[model samples]
Target: MEQHTVVLYGKPGCGPCVAVKAALERAGIEYVYVDVTTSPEGLEHVRELGYQHTPVIETSDDHWTDFRPDKLAALAKGLGS
Candidate 1:
């Protein structure tokens, strides 16, 4: 099965972001994380997505505001559990 690409935009010390990543890792899913807080392109990147918040998890096809267990699951195998 082909895995979807996950681009997680988070700040330096976001608990929710950490939780999301942890869950994904526990599931053995692959993902790329981006810290928008310290990046100069943060505003531009988020603006393009029409979202103005940290911890915006982006899959290849969609964006999840929470990226919690359920949200990550949706992007997991078969859109998650």
Candidate 2:
């Protein structure tokens, strides 16, 4: 299977974002981290996705807000190849 790119949009000093980052790290999943606090484009992208929260996760097939371990785990297992 082709490997999918994983992207995480977050801001500094956000608890949920921190937790999500930790979970992804523990799951051994490689991902691109975007700091919306510093990047206007990143913040715009998060808003365009219809989210008002930090820790927005985006995969080729899905996108969601906050920390979702189950989804993260599924992503790690299914797309970590």
Q: Candidate 2's error at 36, in angstroms?
A: 0.4
Tens digits of per-residue lDDT, candidate 2, 1-81, equal 124878899987999999998888888888899999888998999999999989899988889998888898889889653
- Per lDDT, the best of the predicted structures is 2
| 1-81 per-residue lDDT for model 1 (tens digits) | 134777778887778888888887887777777878667675478768888777787776777666567766666665452
Q: Against the hidden true structure, what lDDT does model 1 obtain?
A: 0.73
Which runs in model 1 stand beyond 4 Å of their true positions? Answer: 1-3, 79-81
Against the hidden reference, what TM-scores do the models get? 0.78, 0.90
Q: Which run of 10 residues does model 1 get worst, by summed lDDT?
A: 72-81
Question: What TM-score would candidate 2 get against the native?
Answer: 0.90
